[model samples]
Target: MDTADAIIVGAGHNGLVAANLLADAGWDVLVLEATPHAGGAVRSGHVTAPGYLSDLFSAFYPLGYASPVIKRLGLGEHGLSWRHAPDVLCHLLPDGRSVTMNRDIEVTAASVEEFAPGDGERWKNAYRDWQDVATPMLDVITSPFPPVRAGLGLAARLRVSGGLRLARRLLLSARELGSELFRGEGAKLLLAGNALHTDLSPEEAGGAVYGWLLAMLGQQAGWPVPVGGAQRLTDALVSRLVSRGGRIVYGVRAERVLVARGRAMGVRSAGGTDWRARRAVLADVPAPSLYLDLVGARHLPPRLVEDLAHFRWDGSTIKIDWALSGPVPWKNPAVGRAGTVHLGADLNGLTRYAAELACGELPTEPFLLAGQMTTADPSRSPDGTESLWAYSHLPFRTAWDAEPVARQAERMEDVLERAAPGFRQLVVARHVAGPADLEREDPSLVGGTVGGGSQAAFQQLFLRPIPGLGRADTPVDRLFLAGSSAHPGGGVHGAPGANAARAAIARDRALTGDLYASAIRAAHRAVYADR
Candidate 1:
């Protein structure tokens, strides 16, 4: 039996973040990854062709650059560099017109002004609102739920009435917010398309916040990619962890979490090896997998097990990566300079696309979230060539057979060709990943759902991964859920893991004195009662 102070069940970015922090605190931490590599969804490789590095899963890094946790970790010092394109994003319309988001607020607003005369000023005002609440808002979203200090600070900044207005906006759907705030299709489409980055539709409540926050973040900090490849980010994290005296073992699957007396003791691997954890066990797997599979249902309460059965997963996805011989040859050449492109005619087109997805039908005119990897980071491919990838949400559990998968990839290329006259001609080689393929590659991305679970209003905050206090603490003692399924649901930002580390450290300190442990236990029971 091997022993350590803390054992992390996965080596995803979030899990690695926890390992780094815990190890830095002078605790011996060990990370076990079922896969042969470290990054779960953040890995990169030449799947398409030689000299072309395509991100296997996640690519853009607007949230990552804005993350305070990444700043604190000083990942840049460990050799993580960011590269941004001339434009952050571009949305191409049916009439060949487009709206581009630039890092400069004035430039982005000007793009909106092309569609609606006075919308430029409106766009600026919205950005100004974002500036006013940016710090406190980030604090609120990334911190533990019921973020008292951050909430109070934001409220003070906005005053009573302004704060109320902000809350109401958060509650509105992306469609409602766009209709209420803008007079033209350009601004509305931008927000709605951004909202679709998650599984949420334009009409889904709480969808407006995702759009508003991501758009603003793009304006403040252009959507960036790692300079070399997405793998560099993972490599930097691994380097930092190793420097701090942490160990990571790949190709080791955690079979079960060992529990005794209702507390997690360690984990037993599929290889018949037991790794003991004297302090804590942090699981970066899905909520259902953690509660029902790893820690058997026999250990869980009846009510909790029932709730886990009802846990909703987000929609599936289909991703296509291409090694292009040349640039995307858009009718509007300006689109070529953008790192990301949203392909939808307008808000109406997006609405119809979402409706098709909701009805479990493959969308004919599917909306795409496409990325030009070489544009963002030239090192991703040879000069004058491009590495491109796009993904679209599909109905949950959609059957993906070989023939249908090939047709779907063709449909995606056709859609791109419609916007960029000769997009298909530029494809030298292509790699397609359907929902089943995605799941086979990364189990954390269950059903090809990227955002962990759905980010709908009902599943957010304290209600995420199952209702309770929105902290990372689980029902079992010394076991913490540190994955994206926890609060602050999904992104490359490592807040969930950091929060889990904080909870574990707090619990460890409290247990040193029996009186402190009693108080902590009582408080936890009160908050989690019947939840």
Candidate 2:
């Protein structure tokens, strides 16, 4: 049997991040990946054409660029370079008008002003408020739940910014926030469209939180792509881990977590290989998979098993990638400046799409979130050509039969054509992945949910993955949830992984190990005391 100080299941970015941190702290770390490659959803491949690079799942990582966790990893030294498009984003309206966001505050303000008379100043004001709280706010977000110190800093800043009023605003639906702040459809579409990036609708409560966070991050740190390919980011992480003497095994699926008397011992692979862990087992898979599939129902608290039964997955996803003959011929030239684009005619269209999903109906017209990879990173394809991909969310139970999915992809292409004339003509090659395909490619996506689980307020913070302490510690001792299913949810940022690593390290300290473990166990008992 192989052994290590820490065994991380899944070589997804989060798992890799945890491995690197553990190794850096002088713990022997081992990573197990079911796939042959490392980058779970963050991979890139020439699926469209030999010369075109398409991100397998996620692209344009604004969260990663703004993440102090990722920043502190010093991935740049390990060959990670970021590339940003000239303009940050664009939302194409039904009337062919483009609302673009630029890194330059004035430019973004001017762009919004074209829609409403005073929206320019409103945009500036919003940006100013974001700047004031960006530091502490991000700290609180990326920290463990209950972020006492960071929350204090943010609370102080918020008092000066808008106090409890601002807190209420953050909890507003994207529609409400937009309507209250900007008297224009353009800015509203921008915010609502960003909200759709998650499995959220414009009218969903707390949708404004995601929309505003991404929008502000885009303004502060332009949505960036790895220069060569999304794979480069993974390579950088793997490089850093290997440099620190971490070992990763490919094609190894962790089938069961070996627990002894309520403590995690290690994991047993599908091939019947038992790998021991001296200290901890950090699972970067989804929450249910860890608690149900790996650990088994018998090992978990009855309440936790019941909670798993009620676990709500986010919506399914359908993604299409195209290798274009040339740049997208947007009817409006300003749309081409952006690396990322949102397609929803207006706030009503967004509402309609979300409503359809809620009713378990496949939308005839979907709201798309797309990325022009070549525009963001020129090296993605041949000069003058584009590597483009778009994805839309649907009901979780949507059937993904090949023919229907093909038809849906056609609908997406139709949406694109409406925004850019002759879009079909520019497609040199295309690839489509429906729910089944996405899940097959990355099981962590579970039913094609890219955000781990639902980002709804009920499933967030302390209630995340069940109503627990919201740290990485699991009911099974020495086990941690180091994936997006934990607090702070999903994105390219490695907060969940970083938090888990810190927790494991703190609990394993030579002088305080027993004390920390005792406290964590007591907290878990308090949370899981009931039936």
Per-model TM values vs. the true structure: 0.97, 0.98
Error of 1 at 157 (Å): 1.7
The model with the greatest lDDT is 2
For candidate 2, lDDT tens digit of each residue in 97-149? 88999999889988889999999899889888899889998999999989999
Tell me how many residue pairs clash in candidate 1: 0
For candidate 2, list the clashing residue pairs, or say none.
none
Candidate 1: where is the Cα deviation over 4 Å?
A: 511-531
Residues 1-531 of candidate 1: C-alpha lDDT, one tens digit per residue: 989999999998999999998988899999999999998999998899999999999999888889988879999889999999999999998788899999988888899998889899999889898999998898888787778888998988999999999999999999999888888888888899899998888999999999998998998887899988889999999999999999999998999999987788999999789999999999888888898889997776656677777778888889999999998898988899999999855888888998998898888888889999999989989999999999988888835677766777788888898888887888899999998888788889887888889888888898888766677887678899999999999989998888888878888877464454455456556654554
Alpha-carbon local distance difference test for all models: 0.88, 0.89
The segments of candidate 2 whose C-alpha lies over 4 angstroms from its true place after superposition are: 510-512
Candidate 2 residue-wise lDDT at 129? 85
Clashes of 2: 0
